[model samples]
Target: MAPVDRVDHNVLERTSLQTRLSEDTNTPEEQLKDIIQDLYQIMVQVSTYDSAGRSSREVLINEIKTLSESLRTLHTSASPPNNLPSVPPELLEYVEHGRNPDIYTREFVELVRRGNQLMRGKLNAFGTFRDILAENMTTAMPELRDDVVQVVEATGGVPPGRRNGEQSQSQPQQNGANSNHASSSAA
Candidate 1:
């Protein structure tokens, strides 16, 4: 039995092709034709060797098949419409790396928007609470109404009795705190 010689055909072909292709001044189509011819010649040369050349034959066949499929695909894809506009690198970079807007549900976005609007129209607790306190003080001590109004005005608060273009109202007939206190005392 003869010893099967194991050879690395890729190393040999790569060295030869690298030298020849580098010096060739042919057009791309001519270069591709030359490659196919060269591969065919190599396939024929490998057949003359013994069974030791089986791997090289398979490698060369697979390479030819791959190159043929690639050439076909390239021919089909090469003629894409020229009207397609090219994306600028800056815009692409911004899209890739910038802080992007979050994707939220339309309902959630609308809810937030409405909440913002309602918040914008909310009553100022400082003025509202101050007005309520001043009104309560005036009711409990009717003689202090003018002084309360003066204090409210000095502090930039709207007196409860004089809000919304209404005139300063007279003190309430029944004070809320006094009525509650009297009811509790009786109980």
Candidate 2:
């Protein structure tokens, strides 16, 4: 489908027949896969709450509850067994807790079903970071954290990590024109 602006990602091009066909005309199985990806992105990335330190801590906890409820729904009807397996280790537990039923809940289920889109975004981030980090990691004082991050990035079922060392995001744009500029120069 040719996206109507708000419906698509920020790609600066027309929808190719291939893209439109793939995105628009997925099989039920494919659509289910896409939803799970979406759930992971939302829960892991966007599902955050801010507190000024005087508000309810329970608010964030409840939000996580809502997310779990949605995921439980998506798990049954849509997600693959591996990620949101039809037979999740927690299914009986969810039922006992009265979170989600066998039937799908649109609010929770839909996002979990959208795995393809979510996974792709994460993968692209990994590749971008990989290029930056691989160029910068050193022999004498290698960052142990970076290696751990790469392991996490490799898991599509979870989330990916940054290849670039921890720096203000603004630093990247400032050095966007240079591929091999070390962090010290940018500082």
TM-score of each: 0.26, 0.19
Question: For model 2, what is the error of residue 74's alpha carbon versus the real structure, in angstroms, after optimal superposition?
Answer: 36
Compose the digit string of candidate 2's lDDT tens values, residues 101-129: 55434544676767767998888777556
What TM-score does prediction 2 earn?
A: 0.19
User: How many clashing residue pairs are found in candidate 2?
Assistant: 17
Quote the positional error of residue 147 for candidate 1 in Å. Answer: 2.5
The digit string of per-residue lDDT tens for model 1 on 1-187 reads 3443554667645554454435355555765675676565555545544567676666666556545544554455444666468664555665678634342245458979999877765645556567667768877887897899799999887654554334435545344445434533553
Model 1 lDDT-worst window of ten:
99-108
Worst 10 residues of 2 by lDDT: 4-13
Which candidate number has the best TM-score?
Answer: 1
| Runs in model 1 lying further than 4 Å from the true structure | 1-96, 100-123, 164-187
